[model samples]
Target: MNDKRASHGFRLTLAMLACVGAATLAGCNGGGDAHAQGRKGGEATAWGLPYFNMPDIVPPNVRQDAYTPLTDAQAGPPIDPIKGYRTEDLGGGVYMVGDGIYNTMFVVSDAGVILVDAPPSMGEKTLNAIQQVAPGSKIVALIYSHAHIDHIGFAAGVVKAFPGIPIYAHEETRKALAQANDPNRPVPTNTFNTLDVDFPVVVGNQKLVLRYPGPNHDPGNIGIYHPGQKVLMLVDVVYPGWMMWRRLGLATNIPGYFGLVKSMNARWDFDKLIAGHFQPGTKADVETQLEFMTDMHNALTEAISTIPYSDGRLNAADTKNSWAATRDWTDRLTNHCVNKVTPKWSTRLASFDVWIYEQCMALEQSIRIDGPSLR
Candidate 1:
């Protein structure tokens, strides 16, 4: 039964494809009200792909063209860190770090500095970004929110910097890392096991809480919470206050993803969110994520409710075409999101979100039902 593949692939953006971006798009310092839509004012289309018309509330400097597959950068199009990694000091030497897509929250505690996911791509400049905050504190702990490469790719950098620092991850996560690290495997550079920590062993730290969000983004995915700062570091499972100029909705398997969101929400919560990517967010993002999940849930419920497609229409879920609920969720995008950026971006968000979701769906179908434990 594990061979369930959706009828078609939905579009996605490079920004919305991972645990960090869509997962953490909810909470921002600005008014935290979940908008019914974004502020994109215009609409455009290209490549026979219908461009989504949006409201007039786009973010700054977003490219409006649909991001077709780029063969150049493996990480999609590269974002400028210097201009974007605008670190905000929350006093006490603690910093909520990121440029919008990949933000890390660093806690300079009495013991040492704890980093929630290193910069996805780190060189001397990335390391320098952290050092500027605390000149000589060892990266005492490296906590990964999920096994996705964007969240853990910089582990090598952190390892090079801290050497034997206590790297933490879900037990399952460590196993995924080993597989990803083997050169023989495809996508060997996946930052699957960058930080190795046992969730049961350190679930409740006096300073921070570590959690295992099973089978949500990945089976080994875990979340790190800093109770003191009210910073919840989890991604992919939930996204908050996301700008849709990217039209990022990479839901691979609707039925399965619905189950995942419910399971993770059963895990943890926080006041301030350090998502895998995008702005530091709030509880509202979790709720928005729930909405998406609920919608998908209902979609599946309707699709499965009716067995024969020729039978009278059952619901969004009843027909074998029930998977359309996944794209239906995206089509309901707030127009303001796509139009919020520069002109000619009607396809940008839809192109990215739709495609990424397709890839995830395709991958989900390829895996075995009783799949190997990432651990």
Candidate 2:
């Protein structure tokens, strides 16, 4: 037999011996339940072997019995069931509308209304909110944050409501929408390039400075800033009090995501942040999220450096298969990273347990493949 086959056979024999020995011990001890014993003993596995305290919420394999409860801060204000959506006036004529889950914004001016994003979840309620707040004003322009379907799915409805209304977005967004060929999100009528300088979209009496800070959550996801209102609307990048959606809000570029968050926190002169989810955020929320992200980065960096590839967890036969070996190594690294962060962050961020594993897995891969640059 070949060396690999021999090694596999030897390891299988050892595993069988270990199992027999374990059974012998149980039988000698009046056939005690190993799983029950494991629970009574500190840091024990199901078979009564000592192990780390694994998190209750593991993903892709382990289904959580119940997710961590949301704190009052994370829940934000309740939406009115009758109206199906709630609108918040953020000073000036800018108002935010959401169905307690998805959010979008609009700026009303003497000339007309400049609406930003049209989440399908909000649907026609977006128009209702605009009518309730702006009253009699026409929607002259619709600005898309990016080409994501969830954020701009209701653009079709907006177009139907106001025909021939000019739609504006970054040049990249237009390209993506055109490629998507999604009728729900008609290609922007007007597109601005965000190469070196910030693009300003002036409609009616309102003006929004659209700056594409490279790719973060998605390519061409621009920051919609209202200088007059001191409100900055950047969607899918920051999650305020809650944990970010899976894979860092499914960011296309991990390094860019990090850099954008740091840049926005440092450069943007805004009091309120409309992060396109839940309620608007403040500088404190941004700082808190930054701190959490930094912790995750540091923990993952240490884990990658300390954890060995040959951790003895993989079967001997699997070593010949590179894909299997890599999967085992990454799983071990991710679990270590998850355990390190859970202690401090579990209660700090809402739904932290829900997506922490995915976040760790994403960062680990980025660190290995994309180079470690959490600017």
Candidate 3:
């Protein structure tokens, strides 16, 4: 394995030099000029390598929003200080509340209401959204999408607003929260320990299907389904329009993350997906993500197999500097994947250029070290 990996790294280094010769030049003053030229045409030439043969596939309905310079809609309605969060009705008593990023779901029923994942960013705004839409409705249940502090960090707020409300989460989430002691995210009131279980939250006329689709984003993150509304709320797993967060949502299990996407694509019969971030996503959005991930994976695998050495800094006899050499090799491998994958993906996905390399680096580490292990 070591010999093969070294050969793979050598090939990758050669490819990097061929693709971005000026940037890879050991000490060239004209590196900046070379980089600029590379941007103009080097990007195209670099992507022509055999590893990146995946067709430039993207969904017809993919979002083309700019990464910076927030448009009026992206900036969110004139920031009313008094009205905390913006609420978008997803119909059938389901709604999404957030300030562009960090979103959660809520459903109103005759009995009361069900709220999912209250991040500290939303804070009291989540309650405001609930009240704005369902006036006089009591929050009866709080669902923890996972044990992540960023997603459910405002548990104290929820408990304060609706005392004694039953909280639902997978058993692993309960355990993780119990161990962490984060004041923002409290332990759940109820927990389930199964990989896949159908636990229904029935209040009055509303019913939500709480499912554990085997730990993808976190140990116990779940997919909340509103059968009547035909909407699925899977937190931190999929970004609606923009690129998936750094490290593919910082997944604990990379393969598990991919599996979760496939599982939802094959099984869910919903129209809209409340993918836990950005704007509301659709089936097409989900499909686009799958395509992006698969393309990156294929490109990374090919580069790893074809490279001649791990890092360009070390030769066959550099046994004394092995650790330093390994570190440098990782960066070279990461950059090669980045240069190769960005061109095709940048045109199709929003902010693809911004986060593509970060995602590539994360995947490179996982693939090289973890070797396709789900965990």
Give the alpha carbon lDDT tens digit for every residue of 1-375 in model 3: 698766665554454445433434422222344344434443323322222221122211223233434445434344456775668898888998876777789998888989999888888888988888878888999998888878888888899888899999889999998899877787898887876768888888889988888868888888889988789989888786668888888999887888888668766778888877677888888888887887777777877787655423244466467685665565556656766777666656666755676787788888887785332
Clash-forming residue pairs, model 2: none
lDDT of each: 0.46, 0.81, 0.73
lDDT of 3 at 188: 92
| Candidate 2: residue 348 Cα off by (Å) | 1.0
Which candidate number maximizes TM-score? Answer: 2
Per-residue accuracy of model 2 over 262-307 as CA lDDT, tens digit each: 7787667899999998889988888888888888899888978987
Q: How many backbone clashes does candidate 1 have?
A: 57
- After aligning candidate 3 to the native by TM-score, how far in Å is the CA of 32 from where it should be? 16
- What's the distance in Å from true for residue 254, model 3? 1.0
TM-score of each: 0.55, 0.86, 0.79
Ordering by TM-score: 2, 3, 1
Point out the worst 10-residue segment of candidate 3 by lDDT: 51-60
- Between candidates 1 and 3, the one scoring higher on lDDT is 3
Better of 1 and 2 by lDDT: 2
Query: Once superposed on the true structure, which residue ranges of model 2 sit more than 4 Å away at CA?
Result: 1-53
Sort the candidates on lDDT, descending order. Answer: 2, 3, 1
CA RMSD per model (angstroms): 14.0, 8.0, 9.3
